[model samples]
Target: MVTGRVARITDFGAFIQFENGEVGLVHISQIAHSYVRNVSDYLQEGQTIEVKVLGRDEKGRLDLSIKELQDAPEEMPRPRMIGRQSPEFENKLRSFLRDAKERGPGEKGGKKRKK
Candidate 1:
């Protein structure tokens, strides 16, 4: 991991410079685990942050993700699985499809037949 100061901010990402005079880009996608709508929301110009090196891109510029240097994210709670594939579900779906088909032509809440 390298510690660097944010050099500049752009619509795409933030530029940072390390102690050894090497500069790298921390792309918006790599700045955090959550959706980053804007680069300035999570980072400020001149902020010091640690980033893990992900090697270089095609242009020889260093690619990094600040999220990698941070601690592992907390596990989110999984939704309760009530075993979705029950025989009852299949029967209900089949009946609904059949009824929707029979009532047809914009009246059964199904698609209207293309003219």
Candidate 2:
């Protein structure tokens, strides 16, 4: 369990300063549903939000979550917004894919063939 005061709000998420002198990030997507455009839309600096100890990483930093504070059950992840279009949507995506393909396979480029 951890207690903290909200320190700042940014496009990505909110930063909280724990009483024990540690900081944690509560990502905007994790804040709530309905597409959070800004973290300030739901939380502000100096506000207090309860967090559950999710787990710590190899660095020994605490990983906290706020979903525990909500009364309802968890919401399923949403699907991708693929079909949306623009004047050059398909062309832009084609260019992106081409660039990615040109970048080559994972890790260092070039592949070895069995002789």
Candidate 3:
């Protein structure tokens, strides 16, 4: 963990300068545990914040994260499955398939009827 001052804010993330004069980037996704719509909402131009050093990027630039220093929120419950449908729905689907088959190839609604 290190203390850094937010040097600049961009559309994608914010740039921070460490005490040793090293610079790093705190990406929008690492701003918070929840969704972040705007970077300004969570950070300012000169705000001093504690950040975790996730690692260096492919280009050797420092990758920092604020959310990593904070506790994560609880996981949301998964949605329930719809499961099987009613008999009426199954019957309707079968009837529709039968009608489509009866209308075979080159039929009025199925395809252009040959003269």
Best by lDDT: 3
lDDT of 2 at 114: 37
Tell me which of candidates 2 and 3 scores higher on lDDT: 3
Model 2 lDDT per residue over 6-88, tens place: 98888888877888788877777677645678778788899998776667678876666676566654676778887768869
**Model 3 whole-model lDDT (C-alpha atoms):** 0.91
Which segments of candidate 1 are over 4 A away from where they belong?
76-115
lDDT for predicted candidate 2 compared with the true structure: 0.74
Question: What are the RMSDs of all candidates, in order?
Answer: 6.4, 9.8, 4.8
Q: Cα miss at 6, model 3 (Å)? A: 0.3
Q: Model 1 reaches what TM-score against the true structure? A: 0.63
* TM-score-superior candidate, 1 or 3: 3
Give lDDT tens digits, candidate 1, residues 1-115.
Answer: 8889999999999999999999999999898877789999999998999888899999999998898877666975567887677899899999888878877755745554545
TM-score of each: 0.63, 0.54, 0.70
User: Cα lDDT of all candidates, in order?
Assistant: 0.86, 0.74, 0.91
